[model samples]
Target: MAAPPTDSFTEFQTNLTQTKAQSTTTNGNTVSRGPSPNRGASVPDNEAIGPESTTQQKWLTEHGIDKSKWVKLKRLNHMRYQHEDLNVITTFLKDFGVKVVKKTETERWYAGYGPDQYVYYARQGPRKFLGGVFEVDSREDLEKLVRDHADTLQTKGIEEMTTAPGGGSIVTILDPEGFPVNFVHGQSQRAPQQMPEKLVVNDESTKPRARQFQRFSPGPAAVHKLGHFGLVSAKFDVLREWYTTHFNIVPSDMLYIDLPNGGRKEVAMFAHLDLGQDLVDHHSLFLATLTPDSSIPEPHVHHCSFEVHDFDTQALGHQWLAEKGYQNVWGVGRHILGSQIFDYWWDTSKFMVEHYADGDLVNEDTAVGYGPAGHEGLAVWGPDVPQEFLH
Candidate 1:
């Protein structure tokens, strides 16, 4: 592949326009736009790190896994955490755009403005990475998972999630690194909140709104849904295999670094839940391999991300967090792979959290891509990548 285009906002806009134009099609007398944009330009490559390769496809075929047997994960449901003080975490969550849906003496369920019943669940306890939650297609799907992997599943049987906002059945499985992975099914859906209207802009060539009155109050960016989360893992290969085999998650992109001998070793992966013909976010989960050269020695949750309204909402939220004295990580930029306008910050738990908007969506038809890993590979237009975020 040729070198990636230079990181510039102007180039991004131009490419976006070209992609939109290419996506339009006409049949008979009717014209319609495709569901996704052309993603060729989003693929990253680096001469310094070595040549890129789409090894994920070969790996999957070699495994000979049948898709019909894998558990169908619909989307990310919520993230669970254990905190010493619920009040502190609650305050932080509110500031981050989550509202308290239901609270008890021991547990609290916080929800965003989106359709999900809740986006985050916190309980009073010692700090612990309880793990992320995913929604499965049906109860039979969860049963099939237990029946097929009886030896590996952590929970003996499905547990009734009565305490949660949307009562459901849950089964927890432990990954190779002993992180809890919860799968839920039969949960009732919540009605979506009214989304803010998309703002109309007046460019030099075209002005849509005659009376322009756009005003925004400085506050938390209203979150739409849980987009994705990432983890730094020492046992990357093991966890990767476990996730890919158990669920219908496929790699959107892989990042590799040159090895000392000659070949390349994949160091990171950005994978999304595959719903076949259904379109979803580019990535619902990301995993970075921990190596000797890594800045952080231990395994940790890198970050959890939420989708917001749009560019203006993200900018105002970034300002809100800045004024609230939260430490910024890296963002206010567009990512090359996901094409999301992003802003990352350090939460009260010292874990990275992100607010993003205008992200690309794809289905199973999207091809997997490979790239080189580095600061430049992180974003196409943003402030210098922070050292703390890389690890």
Candidate 2:
């Protein structure tokens, strides 16, 4: 998908540097004050769910995110997972479109056509969440993370990731909810793999391919890169504060629910990196709040999403997986939030993975939005969202 133009970072930062904002809260709770259904309500302090400024320089300063204090992440590197049967999961992944990078009896490394050497890591054993791996902008950025949570239980010294492809230094930190989040530095890049030709299409407004016919082969939607992943949490507020405070993560949209006494609870947050003037995916992570009375005993992962080339590529990929008898989860629709055309399926291990295309992108200037939490608000159009997909 085409991304928005990114302004020159050097110039943008130079023009807008200032002290960061202090943490602000409402009644000692999170920032999801119930907005009027028709319009956004003012959040406590200036943390309202709206873009306070249009320029990246202005947005950064407003959010109190300066280069030195915030750990700047370059991109989502990969996701690591463990399954009871390596062979079973491997077969499913191949049909799902990733090329194996390196495989042993117990471990498998997978790659997409993107610069990342590996995008998904699988290991044999019981089902377990290994963590979402990220590539930080600099070694200093990694060190900044170390300094932020130095004495916490989540702290771990950096170590060489010798066994993984594109050996790099990595440090693992557990979020307050005890899920591992890895940060890496200095990994070798991989060359791009061959991709399907961009088929020219003629729409009602534009006739671009006058003499050509569009054709495609049935195949797995070959992944381009790891786009984003999601998590469900009972401690949504705590998790939100930790991530938004420590990293350059800021909200694109914050979904909430109103309480009996006219209070507000943040039920869901979709956030993106504050890359100053650079354009990036509308959201890199989605966190949904687990209601206290819900049957789920603990927080869990929602799914891992990958990017495919276009609509044709995604449709073909969807058919391929269905023919292979994989259980379909919720998707083949356009999400209202990021506007991604999404398709999700379950791996042999029961973990959800998605292939999406044509998603929205934003810079720091994009406004933070607020909406109600409901299945009806999920998609602009698609098959009904599965209840199984929720909890």
Candidate 3:
């Protein structure tokens, strides 16, 4: 069967003709459009995110993670979100730079310019997250996942992905916290959609361009594909073990807080696929402990991040979303861990989505690094980290 006509090329360039607009302020809080006043009151710079958020400095140390078993995953495939209204989210998805792959009254799937058939999947109803999906290395791996977790609640058995845009097979497992994680083996692949070529830069040390003048047309920083996402789990230790031991994910970096009297507690981690000798993104998934001070009652996803071209594209994309009146959650900053220049926003459903650029990559040979937990480790520079964004 043929893939749905997503109008990938044409739709990516949509809204380019619309005149750029600025954000309007309501009461006093400046809602995320371009530049605004000093954000009213003085917000603290890089404050820790929990109750007495620091542990003893000595607790910061490196540790080895055991990767005993493996269910090989080729890469992250896509993410799913259940929205209150498909129409509203569809509108936001376009602004977020994912082209429509297929749409129905109750379901819609989106595609990025990347080879992955679809980058995001949405369902209509009360807002909910369906979890990120991964493409397993082989059908045998999918079989292993089902067989290994057969008796556990994680098992739902393998089934054909009939309704999906690109027909394939999928198996979704519920992790320790009941977060749904889907695994796929077979899916049709498509040629990546055409994108603007990379721009050349002339640094102080060297000048590359001699005569060509640089210019750009404002538009959404069209997405390349999904980058990475994070979760704050009440049962952090269990989930971390379950993921790394069961699947081929290993930590690249670990964040811990020192205890008052003795022990050290790891609060967050950045993990990558354990593809030996082959380099992959510094982190394909992130996990963090739910600090006792956080108001959120249960374990849940933090945000889903997507990859855009570079700084200029991300900036324009930020401008486009802010101009559209979407609330900025946090970002337009460089993170200390993965080194991604990130921009985050609250989607129509109030879930956070991110646009990121220039992330680091690692492989099995890269030794995991450890650090102390604090807001300073979050970003190297950008707008002040919003309090709402922490945790």
Candidate 4:
């Protein structure tokens, strides 16, 4: 197959550089632009880099998938899980910014301050990572998915979701690595909660308000929505292909590692749901390659992240968690890739969960970036990356 036109790639690089410029500027001073002159005056030389190549598009074409056939995923709806003790987990989730939406003797659904009914679903059972769930555009899309990937479809057809909140029809499918992915349709929408008022800022030149008043109170950070989640996969390539082919997910960025034979191999990916011109979070899902060299035993969910209101909310939330004596994984730093002010913690069940604010938003036109995969690559400014967090 022929390569995709280079025009898009060129435009993407130009836009990316401009975005970086805007982001790094503070109080009217621009940060160092790109690589320094002493460092060769070019893009940094690293195994990991941005997604300027037509590799992703070319891979799609090779697999006989085109833009039209790509599944239309609306957004990441919620995550499903099983816990040993519902009461303990529920208490932790409440403190973590989720409110109980609905509950029963065996199951419970918790929601953030968003329109969608829930952001998390849990059941009383053995601890297990059920999977991340997605809301699709239509029942037709779900039917088409079954037709195309019948081998992997766990449900024979669209099955009514009687137990979940805002009942919908769902079909579960297993990814190449056996992760259960459920696509839902016809779920009832809830009234969106009122958004917090934007705080007035006093800039160097312009002070928005005449009076400066302190804002913020001690409490759990109210999550606005589900932002993203990640998994460490041994078969990263296979999982990447499975997601991209079956859904309208695209790579926002990729991380590469140096090969013993020379050159580099793509290992970690930050991917987003593509909705054409509509903007969405920088990444709704993250995938990292784990091997014996990385000291990770097996593939598993790394963390599920939710978006809070702002930096102040995040800081307060971190404080709240710290005071409560929740185990900290890593955090209170900004990531270089997605530009989110992030903090992570271990839930009562020992699963990693994260609270992030001020994340980058991207549309289909955004460029996919490539970068080195390491603790340093993970954040621009933060405390040292924890060893447990890396694995």
Candidate 5:
């Protein structure tokens, strides 16, 4: 059986603050405090959400997480929000990588990420967590993404222009479902410099392994540009269709869950899809299953993953985690699909945070075809998942 609720919602919030203080010295940059606790009760969007006053750190701690483990709190690395329609949501996300090819405000905007990309989006009445945005390498990248994805850019109307902290320009648009979308460019107007030393990549092996394959050419660039997202939805089919049609995301594989006979006979294991980029291995997004009878309204991301330069960064994270006394859920396991070494830990909010290296890159000529369903699909090369880590 699922774990029963322990503390009241208010007590949960209090515990969160106290736990974070015990975790780390690095207090992440505070953004607009996100919506208050769900209060185990559904509420309207316009209605003041719980209390806007709470900090993300406090909220995260409430759920048994530590905030300092995250490497990029000061600069938002990624975001995920929700919208009513898939077309509208896809339109905004595509701005990050590919430009819209042909958009008719009447036609749904479904283009985003790349061919093998996977993204998570959820819908619940008028509220949603569409998707999170990541910090980019440069201003040229911002311009380039807009140019490439311009063909797919579709929006009903956009307003609420503002400036980001570093002078980055910000714009907000509504997806087909009425979710808010935000994009920023030319912030700080500075040249992309070396990412922090802690963020550097390291792979010293000169001899190539017989079984290991590197499909992509090496440079400062990586094949999989961004991270992963997990979206939740009651209508998984609708959200899944929207993602596949517009984003060009292919279904690499899916996971199904067998509920205790009282419920549906079988639901998917997490649905795994891939953004067809030879530059990176694994799907850019993974959608966990949700049924209509559940209390949550929409299917959305379970969590997101960031690409560290190499295994050295992963080592740094592991050491840091041990030094700080935070929990490690899984990994140092290598995934067969992406060929990336993995490590999983809980953040201040207890969301899974993945730090990885050496992911597989997929392109036209050398793509690996999708495989059949089963436990093998999730980790072509890792240990079986422990029960406590499944959630």
Candidate 6:
């Protein structure tokens, strides 16, 4: 949308350098514990692990990701809203496949999709937002986690849990970085009653001869679940440290950027992390490098992505966005690591969004790679960077 502010990188570098130097002596004494069966937790580490590229991927895979089983990312529910017009906000998400299913008189709405996580959006009069919900396995699991979190947070009374659309329950908590997060259990089917009615996009050019099946159809909405979120912050180290400390997330890879193609400004490399097995997608969250003069706003969401079932869905998304007058930032490229093919675009508000297909799956043994901060690294499968995207 709005070209991220200029100098975003500069501010990131300056703050990071200071963060590295401003060490807290209290870090070593902290104890590590898993999430309470009821409450959510934060990552425990602040600094990046050694650049032992070869085993990072394998290490992650061993933890729990079955790339082949990953159907599609649904939706990440955001409580924070920058708008007051409920219609405008709901309209935008609905156009992109999110639907408002239920709500309270206070303007809080629960949006659900057959394929993705249910999102809860509540209007806090204009700017205030609340915690979000992530779809999980069952209501019992949700209650247990919420109850555990309350214990960890040491809330004296047991907290009541919320119900979700797909026959599941939800637990809300504040992450180590002070971000509100909710976990959901059990999903109730709400759309596309018939198997024949399901519209699936196919990425494969040909079907296996031995496996003869009927052609598939397209479904109502392409996005099935919430994928991941990227956040921008001036307090890089503080947020980074906070996340790792509270959650079990670990740094799978890290990057440092040097701008202008040859300057010693050494402060521009963006920091990246993977949330491991407790979450979905390659990275549940990404923190870009920031500078005071940087184009992006401080502590802002860089972009959020939705997963498409196949190449057909991905292509349809690209066409839809183009016809609707949106910016197609980057696309149709496969990543070397996550291996998912993706296309990027901006909404009317300039918030960056991605519709991706076939992302690469990583396991404990997958090798991690690094390169200078540039477009070439972002998309391992696309044609050379489009000049327009460089801007």
1-391 in candidate 6: lDDT tens per residue? 1122233444444554554445334657644332222211121121112243435545335545444322122324433344456665565566565567665545544443434334435463554334434544444554555455673342223234353344544456665445555554445555652221334334468544444454633332356554555555566566655544433343444455656776532222222233344333455555555556545444555566666667766676566666666567777676543456777776555566676666543333333444455556766457676654433
Which stretch of 10 consecutive residues in model 2 shows the poorest summed lDDT?
A: 37-46
- TM-score order, best first, reads 1, 4, 2, 3, 6, 5
Give per-residue CA lDDT, model 3, range 251-362, as digits (tens).
7777889999888898888888877788799899999888766766578899999999999899999999999999998879988777789999999888899999988876
Candidate 2's C-alpha runs over 4 A off are 1-67, 151-156, 292-295
- Report the CA-based lDDT of candidate 5 relative to the real structure: 0.42
Candidate 4 structure quality by residue, lDDT tens digits, 147-170: 887898888788998887799998
Instruction: Tell me each candidate's TM-score.
Output: 0.84, 0.82, 0.82, 0.84, 0.46, 0.58
**Per-residue alpha-carbon lDDT of model 1 for 144-184, expressed as tens digits?**
86787676687768989888888999998777777788899
lDDT of 2 by residue, 1-391 (tens): 1122234443333333211122348899655433322211212212333332234354446656555666888888999999998888888988888989898888999998888898999988889998898889888877777777676525357778788889998878888887889889999998767776888878779998988877677889999999999988888888987887778788788888889999977789888887877988988988888866544558888899999999888999999999999999976888878888999998998899999998888876567777788889999778998877877
Task: Look at candidate 4 and tell me the lDDT of residue 73.
Answer: 95
Listed per candidate, the RMSD to the true structure in angstroms reads: 9.9, 12.3, 14.4, 8.6, 22.2, 17.0
Give a tens-digit lDDT track for model 5, residues 1-391: 1224543555555665554344323368444433344333222211212332233233234434332222111122334433455464443333222233333433222212222122222232343344554333445444444554454443322222232223344333432333333444444422332442333223566554555553432212121234665555455555554444333243433444445675432233222232223333445555545654444455434555656656654565566565556666776677644456777765433445566676654432232233333445556455676543444
Candidate 4 regions exceeding 4 Å error are 1-64, 293-296
- Local distance difference test, each candidate: 0.82, 0.80, 0.79, 0.83, 0.42, 0.49
Cand. 2 Cα-lDDT: 0.80
Report the candidate with higher lDDT, 4 versus 6: 4
